[model samples]
Target: MPYVEVSLPVRAERSEIYPILKEMEKYPEFMADLVSVEVVERKENSTITKWVSNVDGRIIKWTEVDLFDDANMHISYKQIDGDLKKFEGEWILTPVADGTEIKLTVDFEFGIPMIAGLLNPILKKKVRDNSLNMLTAIKERMENRA
Candidate 1:
């Protein structure tokens, strides 16, 4: 598995930030590489979203069920089906002084036979870059929000 984690301090209150974070369906609009995201199903505290992302100009898609914990300011997700063998992660939010500390963690594996190890390094970098890009996009949007 390839893991990528990022922690960023955003100058937005946790209450203000959590709402934007809950709106996962809007990711494709702001996150550059996210081409499309649709909420297929939603329950009381969980949602199933299907996403298509362009990575290195190649289209990769996946479906994940996000479990939202409103009280704790956390979002955890695991792949139900995708272009990969295994994908799971979480987004954790903690209150800071006049802001929120957001952390994103992702674990992914291509699940391809034989060449998996060979592609690990490349995939690791991609995951790290993508995570950073996502965080930057969110920070920009949140800070600029009216």
Candidate 2:
């Protein structure tokens, strides 16, 4: 398994950031890697979403279930089925002196044991960079939105 965690401090309140995070469909508007997101199903506290993303010219697709905890400013998601063997993580938002600190954690497994050692490191770095880009995009959007 490969895990990647990225955090960013944003000059925005949790109330403002949480809504944007929940609106996964808008991701492609800011996050270039994301091609499309469709909400397959929705509930008061959870949603099933299908996503298509471009990674280094490869098209990766997945369907995930997201659980949102509004009171705690937390969101967790796990892939029901995807290109990767495992894809699950959480987004945590906490208040800080300046604004809010947002963190993202992703745990994934490519399901190839024979070349695991050779591929894991490269995959981990790609995922980490993608995650950081997402956080940076959100930060810029939040800070500049007025």
Candidate 3:
């Protein structure tokens, strides 16, 4: 499995940003690589979302369960069914002096043992870039709102 983590500081409260993050469906509006995100199921504290994203021109689709911890301003997600063998991560929001620091993490495996050594590096970079793009998009969206 390869792990990627990216963080951005937003000049906004966690309360304000949490709602935006919780609304995963809106991500496509701000993130270019994201084609669509649909909420398949919603519960009091969690949601099952289907996602379609373009990763370097290749389309990847997956459905995952997102667990929200409102009190801590955190979200954890794991893939139930997807193109990858394993995909899971968490988003953490921590208070800073000026505002909030948002961190996004991605842990995944392509599930191809034979070519893992050859593709992992390229895949890791793409994932890292995508993660950064997501954080940047959120930061821009929040800051611009202020």
lDDT of each: 0.90, 0.95, 0.95
Residue-level lDDT for 133 in candidate 3: 94
TM-score of 2: 0.98
C-alpha RMSD of each candidate structure in angstroms: 1.1, 0.7, 0.8
Per-residue lDDT for 14-58 in model 3, tens only? 999999999999999999999999999999999999999999889
TM-scores for all candidates: the values are: 0.95, 0.98, 0.98
Lowest summed lDDT across 10 adjacent residues in model 1 is found at: 93-102
Candidate 2 global lDDT: 0.95
The regions of model 3 sitting more than 4 angstroms off are none
Which window of ten consecutive residues has the lowest lDDT sum in model 2?
Answer: 110-119
| C-alpha RMSD in Å of predicted model 3 compared with the true structure | 0.8
Question: Model 2 over residues 25-140: C-alpha lDDT tens digits?
Answer: 89999999999999999999999999999989989899999999999989999999889899999999989999999999999999889998899999899899999999999999
